[model samples]
Each structure stands twice: as C-alpha cells, then as structure tokens.
Target chain A: MTELEFDYLRAYLKQRSGLALTPEKRYLVESRLTPVCRRFGLATLRDLVGTLKVARDSAIEKAVVEAMTTNETFFFRDRTPFDLFRDVLLPQAMARRAGQRRLRIWCAAASTGQEPYSLAILLQEAGVKLAGWQVEIVATDLSTEVIEKGKLGLYSHFEVQRGLPVQWLLKYFTQIGEQWQIAPSLRSMVDYRPLNLLNGFEALGTFDVIYCRNVLIYFDTPTKADILGRLADRLGPEGALLLGAAETVIGLTDRLSPNPQHRGLYGVAAPVVRAASPVAPPVSQLRVAAR
Target chain B: MTNDPAETRTCLVVDDSAVIRKVARRIIETLGFAVTEAEDGSDALLRCAEAMPDVILLDWNMPNVDGYAFLQALRQRPGGTGPKILFCTTENDVGAIARALRAGADEYIMKPFDRDILTAKLEQVGVVQADAA
Candidate 1:
C-alpha cells in the first residue's frame, strides 16, 4: 500500500477507534487489512482504503476497527497479576467494600475472556465470604468477534495451556476432543460486552477495579491521555487500575497514582489540581519492568 | 513393558502450563511409569509428602513458588528418600542448565523437544529400560 493509503486508513482508524498507528506499523495495517480487502471483493488494501474513505456505512467502519484491533490473549497470562489480585487486591477490596455488600470489576479489553474467568475462579476459591456480597465482573473488548469468543469460553488445547493451572483446568473445564470449554459456573460469572474504549463508557457504570493491561502501548500520547482521563472518571474513589507492567500513568494523567503495595497496580487518587490545569505532577510514577 | 522391577519407576510432573502437563503425561505413560501432576512448587511438595515418586519432571518458571524452591523443599523432607528430579524446562541457557544440574536436577530437557530425545534421557536415567522399546 502507498503511504497515502496507509495515512488515510490510520487517520480514519484514529478518528474512529482512538488507536494511533505510526509509520513503522504500516506493514501491520497491510497484513491485517489484506484479508478484509479480499473478503470485501476489493483488489487491494489501497482499494479498500479508498472505499472506506467515502463509505458512511457504520458497518464498514466497525469492520475496519475490528480488523485493526489486536485481540491476542490466553488463559492465566502472566501469573503474577492474578496472584496480586488474589493475595492483595481482592482481600483489600473485599474488606473496604464490606459495608456495600456489593463489588464490581471491569476487565477493559478482556480478549477472549481469560482474565475475567481467571478472576472469577479466584473469587470462587475465596468461598462464602463473597457469597452474600453481590459480585459482577464485566469483560469488554473493541472486537465483537473476540467478545463472542470470550462469551463462549471455549479454548483449544494449546490456547488453554499458556498459563492455566492443571487443577483448575480439571475442575472448571471440560475437554471435548482437543478443545476445552470453561464450565458454565465460571462462564456465567462474567458479562462480556463489545466496547470501544474511545467511546463513551457511561452505560458500563463505575467499577472498583479496572484492568486495562497490555493495551495502551498502541495508542499515541493524546489518545492515552484521553483514555486515562475517562478511566479515572469511571473509577470509584478507592478503586484501583491495573496496567501492563510497562505501562504507567506518570506524565500522562494525575487522576491516578501507582499503588505502592503492588507493582503495575494503580489507585484512583484525589484530583491533584483543577481540571483546567494543563499538567500536574503525577502523585507517583513507577515503571514496572516486564517479567 | 519391562519385566525388571527397577524399571518400574514413579514420576511426578510439575508445571503450571496445562499443555505441558498433557504432553508430559503422554511421554511418561508411554515410558511405563505412573505419573502424578502438580501446578506449582507448593502443590508439588504436598503431593511429594503423600507419595515420593522415583523421578520428577520440573518446570523452572512458575508462580506462588518455583522449581528451585520445590527442589529445596524436597531435600528438607524427612527420611531422605527424595525422588531423582529432571528439570524439563524451556530455560536453555547453558549456564542456567549447568546451574540447575548443580542445584540437583538429574537431567534437563528443553521446550519443543523431540520425543525420541526425551525417551533416550529417561532410559539413561534407568527409569525406562531399553527392552521396553
């Protein structure tokens, strides 16, 4: 594809999905969009870009966003985060929310439902202390296709093996031939939704813990700033945010601060300055090296 | 199957990855040994306390405890009848493998392994008799 075509698609995608694509990622667009072009009967990515430029159809735009979004994930990825959730986050959250008798968590960009289901299993293992409390876990992704897969909770042998524990697998998953389907008890605990992070999140409501891990690296500075602002607004006062080990809110937004207790974990901080301020010193900035 | 009683060894499989467990189970079963599995080091130690296997296939990377901790725990157990352990892991750095062997791994296997190589290693360890082939 020509630079003009790449720029056109990048600009369109940025405007639609808030995902920034740089020149180095031009090949990524070509490779991913080539299939879309073929499916649409367009000769090439350039042709597809040309058609998309004038196409006012919402379906076409949706398809572009879906094609552009990367939804790579597997069960129990990077075990430490889940350990932190079970050992530190959940216990503390449970104690603080004891009065409310309810808790809410959102796994933003939850690809294929692994993270949310893993969280549900952790809570189930915690037992009756959580029984009386109303618990809801909402898992969302920009790709409708991946969201469907997440709801289905079916995984191939290789996919399930990535980080899942055998005991949990034998207990919560049933193997049918080479594929394993997560049991209904675990599947029913999470509500999967198709959500574009750039869009309004008003309907999703506030959450006590929001996991937006390993996702923001694709976005440019401005998009990250906007998404962080929206995420901060949607967090409860004492709520927490979990980012990818390499991600941070430092120099980006002051609405959230790094949680000292857990690496790659952040908490909603009180507004440091009025919204009108261009930038405020981040309450705390710590870069968690990837394990 | 081997008629030699010494070849009828027990093996424990410790890995957090379900895929690895499934593959290891098939390999160990084919070698004519009873296999038990644990997800992490802590769980493996608990299993070890109940039944001491003749050999263990341990993965290096795991959460809530790891292969090194499990090895140490095994040595600390009373009676000193600890099973021989082979570190079957993806950590292929020569120095790391040497360190693991020094730390008490009887053998080391790399990831994306050939079944023939694994079987040869098992035979070398006397867990599987050559006649079993």
Candidate 2:
C-alpha cells in the first residue's frame, strides 16, 4: 500500500467507523485488506478503495470494516474482571438495585458471546440470590459474523477450555459433538445485536453495569475520550463501568473516575459533566466535538 | 455419579475406532476432565445410564444406536438435566450439522480435530467455563 493509499484508507476508517489507524499500521492495513482484494478479485488496494467510493453499506464496505475490527475473545478472557464481577461488583450491584429489583448490562464488543454468557453463568450460580430481580444483558459487536455466532451460543472445544472451569463447563454447557453450546436458559440471558460503539448505543437504555473491554485501544485519543464520555452518560446513577485491565478512566474524562477499591473499574463521579462540548444536547451529539 | 466440585468432571468419548478414542481421550484427559470411551452408541448409552457425564462427545453412524438415535433417546431421559451432547462427524456436510441440531445435539465436531478445536467446542457447549472459575 502506497503512502497515499494508506492515508485515504485511514481517513475512510475514521470517517466510516471512528477508528484511527496510525502510520505504523500500514502493514496491518495491507494484510487485512489483502483478502478482501482477493475475494473481490481486485489486483490492488487502490481498486478496493475505488469500489468502496461509490456506495454506502456496500458489501465491500462491510468486508473492509469486518476485517479491520478485531474479534479475538474468549470466555472469562482475563480472570480479574470476572472475579471482581461475580465476587464484588455483582453482589454489590444486586444489593444496590434491591429496591428496584432490576438489572441491565451492556457488553460492548461482545464478540462471539463468551463475555455475556460468562456473566449469565455467574448470575445462574448466584441462583436464588437473584430471585426476584429482572435481568437483561445486551451483547453488541461491530461484526455481524460474530454477532450471528454469539446468537448461536456455540463454541469449539478450544473456546470452552480457555479460562472456563470444568465445573461451569458441566453446569452451564452441554456437548453437541466436538463443540459445546451455552445452555438454553443461559443463551437466552443475553441479546446479541449488531452495534458499532462509534454510533453511540444510549438508545438501548441506561445500564447498571457496562463491560466495554479491549475496544478502546483501536481508536485515537480523541475518539477514545469521546466514547468514554458518551458511555458516562449511559450509566445509571448506581452503575459501574468495567474496562479492560489495560484500560483506564484516568485522563480520559472527568465524568468517570477510578474506583478506590478496584484496579480497572470506574464509577460515575458526582455532577456528571456530560462532556464539555455539545454532545449534540439536552445531551450534545455523541460524535466527537470539533477541536 | 459424583457431585464433588473438586472431583474431575467426566467426558464420555464414544467412537468405534480405537485410534480416534485414544486421540480424543488424550485431549480430553489433558483438559483435566476424566475420559470414558465407548466403541459405539450402544456402549455409550449403557455408560451414560450408569453416569451422566458433564459432556458427551458422540459420533454419528455408530452401530446399534447411532449418534442421532442416542441423542433422541438421551433427550427423552427423565432427569434433572441431561448431559450436553456434541456429535462428531467425519463429514463437513451442512446437512449433517443441521441434523445434529435437530437430534437435540448441543454442538458438533468434525474428524481430525486437535486440542484447539475440541477445547473451543467444549467451551461453546458450556461443559467447561475455563474462563469463569
């Protein structure tokens, strides 16, 4: 890919998906788009870009973004988050919501449903602890392919072994052949849908707990902070936000602050600033504000 | 028959071929779950009656009670919860996958699967939440 072509592709990804690809990502762009080129029978990246120029929602457009968006994930991925979730966050959230008796969670970048299903199993393990509370988990990903897979709640034998314990394996999953599937009740606990975090997902309603992990690393600083700001607006007063272990609320936005008791967890600070710019108001636009 | 959480969970591997059983057995045991082998569907059913494994890696086209037949019968067993059944097939036919789903199979696997494929399918079926605990 020429410098000129790389520049255009970078701009296209930003405009179309709010992803900011740095100059170092030149090889990444080439490798990701190479397959798309072969599939469309285009000889060069330039030709692929040319085809994308004409139509919105073109097949090429979808394929390009799907290729760029990383879908790597597994059940309970990092141990800390799930541990905090079941042992500390969940029980506390349950207690805090006892008066209302309802809970809603959103898993941004849900990939193929491992994260959400993991949450379901925890809730299931809690059993009677959640006796009367109504619960809903919304798992969203930019890739329709993974979203569809998430809906099926199927994983290869490999997926089940990673981070998932044998006990949960027995309790929550049933073997089909060489693959395993989430139990019907657990699968139904989550609603997986096509969502791009850049589009802003507040329309799904405020959530008590939002797990948006390992997704912020893809964007530039402005996009990262902007997404964090929008996420702040979506948290219920009693809610907490769980980010990837490597992620932080520090310096991103004044609306969310690091929780004293948790390393990677953030909570809404009082007097939510709601992004200093016109997020598009009542709340200003969720899109990044002009500098 | 065991309810002890610390007791290694059981995986009943049913395949007529001794070689496939050995290969699957090594992988499943390495996964830390106890492995039981059955040469065909009849043996598999008898083993299952004695104990409902956490996960069952079933093979289609077995003698006497085939994978589909075992699946249909297994689902009908009166119980608290039946074992999660994953039907293994040598064919990559879409029709076969659809049939497995219809037969109340929890998931499916193809022949010559390695540790990764088996692990992923097991996680998908929830017989193992390696990430959760």
Best by DockQ: 2
Tens-digit lDDT track for model 1 on A1-291? Answer: 888888888898888778888889988888888888787788988778778877776776787888888887756555567878888888988898989988899999898898999899998998887889889999999888888998988987556555564446566887766577999988888999888888889888998889999899888898898899999988888888999878999999988899877778988886556468566455453233322
* Candidate 1: residue pairs that collide: none
Please, what is the whole-model Cα lDDT of each candidate in the order they appear? 0.80, 0.82
lDDT of 1 at A204: 89
User: Which regions in candidate 2 have their CA more than 4 angstroms from the true location?
Assistant: A55-57, A272-291, B1-133
- The 10-residue segment of model 1 chain A with minimum total lDDT is A282-291
Quote the TM-score that chain A achieves in each candidate. 0.90, 0.90
* lDDT tens per residue, model 2, A63-142: 99889988888787766788898998898888888899989999988998999998998899889989988999999999
The 10-residue segment of model 2 chain A with minimum total lDDT is A282-291
